[model samples]
Target: MQSSISLPRPIPRTALAQAVLLLLYGASAHAQTPPTAETMLTPVTIRSGAEQENAITPVTGFVAKRALSATKTDTPLLETPQAISVVTRDQMEAQGVQTLRQATAYTAGAVSNYFDSRVDSFSARGGTVTQYQDGLLRIYGTYNTSRPDPYTLERVEFLRGPTSVLYGQGSVGGVLNLTSKRPQADTLREVQVQVGNNARKQIAADLTGALDQEGQWLYRLVAVGRDSGSQLDHVDDDRLVLMPSLTWKPNAATSLTLQALHQKDKSGSLIGFFPWQGTQLPSQYGQIPRNTFISEPGWDAYDTTNNSWGYLFSHQFNSDWTVRQNLRRTVSEVDYRTIYTSFTANAATGRPARPVFNSDNRTVYRDASWQINGGRMLLVDTQIEGKLHTSSGTEHTVLAGLDVQRNQTSQSSWRSVTAAFDVYNPVYGNFRPPTASQLMRQPNVEQRQWGLYAQDQIKWERWTATLGLRHDSAQTDTEGRPAAAIDDKAWSKRAGVTYQMDGGWAPYVGYSESFQPLGGVDVYGTPYKPQRGQQWEAGVKWQPPGQGISAYAALYQLREKNRKTTDPSNPLNSLQLGEVKVNGFEAEMQASLASRWDMTLAYALTDAKISRSNAGDQGQSVASVPKHTASAWLSHRFASEGRGGWVVGAGLRYTGSQWSGTSAISTPSATLADAMAAYDAGDWRVAFNVINLTDKVHITQCLARGDCFYGQARTYTLTSTYRF
Candidate 1:
């Protein structure tokens, strides 16, 4: 089933440049028309010190005062009445993080189950999280999307719990928003080179400043090139990224930022799906080496290319009202191929047993798969914000918005059983290629969704209240498969209240809802109802006045219904009669003490269970969710009369034992260590970092289905950066 609709082509550079010029010209013309009577009557307030902190701006230290993710407004974290975590660029640089998962390692309620280079797979509050860039959703389809490079982002934010009131149809866990680096008025130029273990080499540059004397136009360019090898043999990690942005501020009241991205990745899968016998449990042949390569060296590959163009526009009619519009289009393609171990029938029971290991415990059966996937997505959002005062002296901030999204995807795949290979002694080019008959053509899928939402924040005295509601309608069509088409409509709501107390303490409570549409029909020919989620959370935030510290502790309970489960009446079919519940507690604190020391502490406790299900597995623990996780990081800088200084840091991470979704198997807990040392001079800095300093051999997780994933090994890197 080939797709009849062709993919959209990239916009020409000349056309794009012309369009930008026209927009700037029009904006300038409008600015010259001068201020209206209404604008002249409105008062403008200047922000200084901490009041200048906003969602997209650079932070001075580890603690952030304001974030825009919770309410899509520049609201103080203490007043948002929700749990949010902000990972700043300073924090990422200090920790030497290279991936999204690594950047959030210290955040409460965040978890990563395995190590994979192909994608950044992580979860929060025991459920998968949706990814967003600059307030717009990043629609992904069947391994066709490219991973974001951390170097190109200003900050990463994690919002805990359901957020459907703002973002349409999404996971109940939360939303991970990546803020891109935008043009700035202040000039900045920097270049960095890095070398690390596993034959890694990299270079990166960031340049941003004003483009004209009037400071009306600003531009920024960021690029990275890297080549590295993984802990696994014969697998490489390579990437190229280029991001450029331009901002036009014809006047103080209106601004527009144009951004474009091009990224390409060449990497292979790191997971081998090794049997539990040799990796987790003891075997006659002893433990298998962690670097053993299971897939064919030359045939195994995961390559991707991504391109996107977007703009963020905002205008203020007056001090009391403002409007904003954001739009983006993204196209991605992926070529994936791999070989993994396959289970064989048990000799006596005739049931599928664990991956068949030879008597020597060195050979295993395998299967191969190849796929080509393409995806295109377009997103647009428009919103109006207003501030009003009631007759009773109460203040109100209201917001109303409409957002629409379109996604199209195509895939063709083939799979077949392949020859077995010995793990101890490798042999390649012996397996047969997949035949034409083994090819499978998947239906082209197209989905369109639109949402309308409104929110209000009322404030009187020392109390604040928040109320929100949203309605969403979605349609999904499968090419040549009308029977599978789906039409879904849903309503989401959110409400919260907070009371500001003396000494910088705010205790709040909030309730939020979410929904995700399901596509296929059940065995009875009835369409499955969309999965629904709701959460109740209460927390207290403390950020003492004039203190460079922020802290919060929260408790939440979330429930999700309509999950798919095996039908007891018909084993071959499935039913939507499953439910899950997670009760969790989280606490975190970040501080920059007296400009000499920086530290962060985090702890999380998650209790997740299958509350209801048609299958016999009711009451079972959820897979890949740990019961306890904690981390702490501390760094100190030694000042040397402003000429140069030395900094040193160390951190520890602990993951408690987790259930493998089965009563008979459980993954063990492990704790790892990380350390960094750096020296800063007038215009240059050098740093050395070591992750997993002890090189502990541990299993991240294992499945009852018969495989285990290995944790990352020790890694070392040296980086030198120069600023001009």
Candidate 2:
């Protein structure tokens, strides 16, 4: 284990000219806009030609209608079929991406951060990824749970692969839906106001209409809040959000929807990004000052809070029969503690400053789902499909369904100042008055899980196909005496072919499989087998998105063999002779062009590996997991040149160099960039944004063993909006 890292020959790029002078001072933060909050939208319509969409399940078998829900680009991301990614709300408002760790780092093969400051993780294609909203499933890690807050979201997607038949147990390196925000007909009002550079205050709002007067009921309401103070110098954050929704159609085969969300957050921790040794670039930042955080450390500080509510039911009993149901109840909690000091270059006492440690945790998760479907019956497309085809006709469109997903995630944990409990040392800065016997106690270690799954999807005519089989059973009880339960069952499959193009090419080929579980328990109570992942995909799908602008390109090979790692001196002792393989390629191009120029460009090339480990062929490479990632967005609109006023948008992003663990420990990050500008007059708006445009030096941590973390070295924000 040696490679003291040596390289400095002409290595004075000065963090690449201070990241091109902080991306030219954030590409010169120009501003204006009417986008302050109301779930900020209105910039979608990138593609407007080539209509015909269907797939909530055709891509895999039950993820059907979604493109964010198109006003264009809403809910139709190239007609699903696996290997998906849609972070839209107009690309998270041109990448001002707030939370869910900045919207899973612009997808493509997701990779998140915040492992130190108490966990928030992600991994895609190669393994480790969870958080599904509309389709259930949620598990955030580092002792699992707590990573939800993309502002109650309305678009998140990202269903790559291995979803135990509609999500039972996870990690084939995929899954993260989040949608939820329906209720619309038009007529809305929005408000957003922002101020950046610590004291970075923010406000958000939304209002929808059409309640009666015959419109058959439709309403919506949303709110958001953020009180910031960090650029990392002892971190600080505060957030609050509320959501309301309702939709009902009195005729046309029946319809109804309902929604609710309430959240509170006090954040800090999520700042780590050190490794330049002593200082330079923006002159060595992060002391809890990317806005402010340190939450419980040195003087004791950390206060995080969460609250959740959910309910949904959908019905359609006429378009060949349909039924959908959802229920959610969540109670989230987090409290942190941290102490800081870092600046060590002790090569014989040349520099000094050390003392950094922290911890604080809390979580509660719940899940449920039910669906039933029937289509023109006759099975496998033979109700005179294509008039009873013969080796020549083509008309097979059959779909049958029965799905059930039930999730009960119960977890409780707190490990701070625990030397057998009753340990207090908070009188210095009054760490919130701790001295009731140093507050020591035990008996809050509980982790439980429950699951059940089923699926099916098929269509023929341009060769659309899928054969999904599911039977996932789980029960992991730790604290209820039975410590572990596994009703193991599996059968997952997918086969594909798509070729129906002429001005918008549609080329496809596929194979898919996934499911993994074992919440906890393996001290010999036995029961662990559900780690199967397979995928070989080929792609080409360019759209006119309803007909106007569009793009897509994909080439992939993701394979996971008997993968299950974590027996490192018995951390619950689970083993499965690991093996991870990820070969990736993706390219996309979005356009509005000509009529006011709208843009989007995405790219990724991953080569994740750990080919074999568990003390065998340790073929490393899989820490922060990154081979290369690219992102883009450009906007222009000068319209009538005057009058009401208009102009908004600009963005560029890049991520490269990863792997700080999985045995490789190959830390790499510095090809980062970001910028934004906005203005619109009439309803009023203003904007400004800049992030790591070249603040370089990046790293996302994940270490529960002797701890480690670093990320977010540069940042900026400014916003404004009002429309009523």
Candidate 3:
């Protein structure tokens, strides 16, 4: 794309050379210093999985003592004054979480497990959720981005509400941040092998330790290989993942960590968007099995690979000041091909219907040709943090930072029509696939962002207040379409106050705002303004002293405007006159009730409505948003005889009814059950998890008349892990 915006240049060679010289000088100047007691001490990874020594209290069960997403600083969750949830590694392992959605299924206000079976995509409140890695934004060309291996992460944090005050451009609903396992001073080794339904098999290994006796160098390696089958007759899912990381500490005040990952996924499209007649309701042609494969086995294909590398460097100039920098580069490619049934007849016909075919036969399909997609991203951020005391003897934590990001993607596709086939007994090899002559290419796109932000946390006695502000400038361009270019600027702000009372009770209130630049232009060829979101929240938190329980309840309302809606006059463009509002409440509790029992409880209620729109959607309920959701999980552990023990866990999840975009279509409410059993002996543990234990069949969501998606069916997995 031709653009008038000037891109930032790389660091100058002189500056790079100076940095190298300074590094050498620093190392040589401090190499001969006498070793002391602090030098002999090893770096400790706290219970919250934080590398810093001064972290929150040790956490167990489903409760996390601290969260990093709320402030980008290590702060206790109870004192952050923001609604946040952390899925600890212990919790994910207990649930046998395979996908990101499964890892957060029990969290309140998170609605997932709907579409994008290949990737992790969810909605919080009433807006989309964006994924971040270690507080850095990962560029996504579309909603369906590359999926990261869940096993590689040490934890996942969700900050629920407008977060643009820290992150420049983002969805107001929330942010999901994945923290990768890094090298720790303590030596650790583990190996795991798993077997599951559909002939699935997997092997994984994790190793971390000091590379040298001086403990100045540390390294970690993680690898996984998997092969699995899907619910479809011929589709399969397979993957290979590898991650390597290293840390170098020249002194106690300075540390550098380098991390890299490579992943390859080979699978078929998991989408089974079936006609409403046969999927949502019974049809005259009889019902299709839950595992039916309507698409041609020969034409379906999905192959993708992702590579990412990053580094985190932190230096403490003194006891009260620190500087840190983080940078990453990522590249990904995708090849997809599938032939899906687009639609069916509106009337109760006895067969599938298509416009290309002359008659409505039991089988009618189109040839969805090959599609290629590619993406690349570069992100960099540098910040300085300091602790200061006010004139009144109060304390303050201040942080200032600058960040830049550049991302781009390209896509091209080919397709053609096809003849009909019988549904009862389909026959293949009769029709030839489309050729390269019918290919179509989409315009290559690029987006760039630059942001500057600052935050201050003021503490006086039992009262803490946080204030933040950020300014962002972004631009978007299309390779072959100059008219689609956009340039936008936004300012975001946030403020919160928390009062810590005796007996471990904290009451808090917060307000935050967000802005996201929209990509396309309106019908009149004028660029649309960025979407603006604002939220108000109030909550109370409690953690009784000496008790193993943490509880919280929050009430919040969020509204967004400048949304784009279909333009009836042109049909080819959109108009920016849409708005949505969500009013909700969330409550959750995690407790270690006794010596052998642990439990978690959660509930959420969301009322999302279209306040304004230009497409006749005003006053309608937002699609895929259930009004009420609740869940509970309990586990019991049996005493062990020397080196053996056992545990059993059960959970229940409830989802209330929700309306589709179409007023007449509604997804019915449903409840599902899950169970797990595990045995621990010596250095090994064997566990089994069963999801949807009752084999309930329900629709996760129905978007329109002929669009319906079934919830995941009953599935089980057995895993064995050995520690050395």
Scored by TM-score, the top model is: 1
TM-score ranking from best candidate downward: 1, 3, 2
Clashes of 3: 1
The better-scoring model by TM-score among 2 and 3 is 3
- The regions of model 1 sitting more than 4 angstroms off are 1-31, 35-48, 343-356, 432-440, 640-644
Query: If both were scored by lDDT, which would come out higher, candidate 2 or candidate 3?
Result: 3
Model 3 C-alpha lDDT per residue in residues 498-585, reported as the tens digit of each score:
9999998999999999898987777688989999999999999987866667788999999998888878788888877889999999
Identify the runs in model 2 with alpha carbons over 4 angstroms from their true place. 1-80, 86-95, 98-100, 104-159, 163-197, 200-428, 431-494, 502-511, 517-524, 531-542, 545-548, 551-636, 639-646, 649-716, 719-724
Better of 1 and 2 by TM-score: 1
Return the lDDT, model 3, position 112.
Answer: 81
Scored by lDDT, model 2 comes in at 0.51
My TM-score estimates for the predictions, one after another, are 0.94, 0.30, 0.92
TM-score, cand. 1 vs. native: 0.94
Poorest 10 consecutive residues by lDDT, candidate 3: 49-58
| Predicted candidate 3, C-alpha RMSD | 3.9
